[model samples]
Target: MNNNTPNNNLTIESLWQFSLQYYSMREIKEACLNLQNHFHGNVNLLLALKWLDEHRLTFPSSQWPQVIQSLGRTEALLLHFRELRRKSKQHLPESLYRDSLQFELQLERQQQADIIDIIHRIELSKVEAPHLVDDYCHQLGAEHLAVIFNKQRL
Candidate 1:
C-alpha cells in the first residue's frame, strides 16, 4: 500500500516506513550493517522485532520457528541484489551503476514489505513487556540475537 494512505490503526506499511526511517538513523544503520555483515542478521526481522517490542506484542515461544520459516526468500533476495549491485559497480558505467544501486535499494524495500506481510499473518500473543525483545531473539535461536536489538550488551 502507498504509505500516504490513511489507516485507523498501524499497518504493515506503517511498520515498513518505521523500519525505513528508523534504520536510516546513523547509529541504527551502522549497527544493523554490522549485524548483517558479521552475524547474518536479517534487518527486516530486527525492525519488526523493534515494532513488536514497542507495541508490547510477541509471538509465542512455540511459534518462533514459524516466524523464521515465514521469512521465505528474503535472504536469497538480498544476496541476489547484493551480487547484482556489486557486479554493476565493477562492469557498468557510473550512471548505470548508480541506477542499479537505486534499483537494488527498491528491491530491498520490497523484500521488507514481503517480510511484513508474513509478520501480519501471525496471531499476537501478548507477553511481559520488557522481555519481548529478548524473547524474540531467543525464538530466533540465540540469546545473542538480542544484541542486535541492543536488549543485551555484547
Candidate 2:
C-alpha cells in the first residue's frame, strides 16, 4: 500500500479514472447500482474497495466510523439527490428523469472524491487481494458479495 510499492500508482485522479473504467465494464454498473439501491452500499466506497484491492491495501472495519464521519456531508447530499432521482423516475416525465439522474451521478462522483480523500488520510494495511476483498465485503455487509467481487470480466 505504500507509494513505493510496484503497484502503488494510486492518486486521486487515478482513482477516479479507475472508477470510470471499472464501472464501465459489462454488468458492473448494474451490480453497483443494485448494491446502492438495495443495500445502502455507497458506490464510491465500492469503487474505492476495488481500487484498494488493486493496490493491495486493506482497511479494517474499525476505520469505517472515521470514514463515515468524514463522508457525512457528501453522503447526505448524494442520498438526498438519489432519492429525488428515484422518485422522479417513478412519477415524473421521462425528460426530467434523465436530469435528476444526471444530478445524482454528479453527486456520486463527488462522494467518490470524498471517499478517496478519506482513504488517503487513513492508514492502510498491506495484504493479499483476497484478504482485502474479504475485509471489504465483510465491512460492507454484502450478503451477495461473491456476485459483485467475482462478476468482474477479467
Candidate 3:
C-alpha cells in the first residue's frame, strides 16, 4: 500500500471516458440511480469505484472522507438540479426539461472531475477488482450494486 505513485494508465480523462461508457448501459444506469435514490450513494463515486476496480486499483477506505468533502458542493448542486428536474417534469416544456437534464449532466461531469482530482492526489493500491467493488458497495450498504457493477464490468 504505497501512499503515492498511482498507475500511469489511470488518468482522469480515461476514468471519465470509462464512466460515460459504463453508465450508458441501461442496467448499469438503473442500478446506479437506484443506489443513489435508495441508499444515498453518490453516482460519481460509485462509478469511480468501478473504474478503479476495472483498473485493479484500490481506493482505500481512509480516502473516502476526502472524496466526500471534495465532492460536497458539486454533489449538492447536482442533487438540487436533479430535484428541480424531477419536480418540473410535468410543468416544464419538453425542451426545457431536456436543457435541465443536460445541465444536470454537466454538473455530474464536474463532480466526476472533482473525484478524479482527489484520485490523482491519493494513494491507490493494486488489488483484485471484485474485492474493491465489493468492499465499496458493501460500505455503501448497496451490495446489490456490487453484483451489477461486477457483472457489467467492461
| RMSD of candidates 1 onward, in order | 5.5, 3.0, 2.1
Candidate 1 C-alpha lDDT tens digits along 39-146: 666777777777767665666666667677756766687777787788667778999888877876776767667756655666665546646556655644556646
Candidate with more favorable, higher lDDT: 1 or 3: 3
Point to the candidate with the largest TM-score.
3
Residues 1-154, model 2: lDDT tens digits: 3464443455767878888898898688887877777767777877777777766677667777867776686888778777767666778988888788777777777777777777776777777644544455566677576467655733
Q: How many residue pairs clash in each candidate?
A: 0, 0, 0
List lDDT for all candidates, in order: 0.66, 0.70, 0.81
Best by lDDT: 3
Residue 93 lDDT (model 2): 85
Off by over 4 Å in 1: 1-10, 128-132, 135-154
Q: Distance (Å) between predicted and true CA of 131, model 1?
A: 3.9
Q: Which pairs clash (backbone N, Cα, C closer than 3 Å) in model 1?
A: none
TM-score of each: 0.74, 0.77, 0.89
| Cα-based lDDT at residue 82, candidate 2 | 73
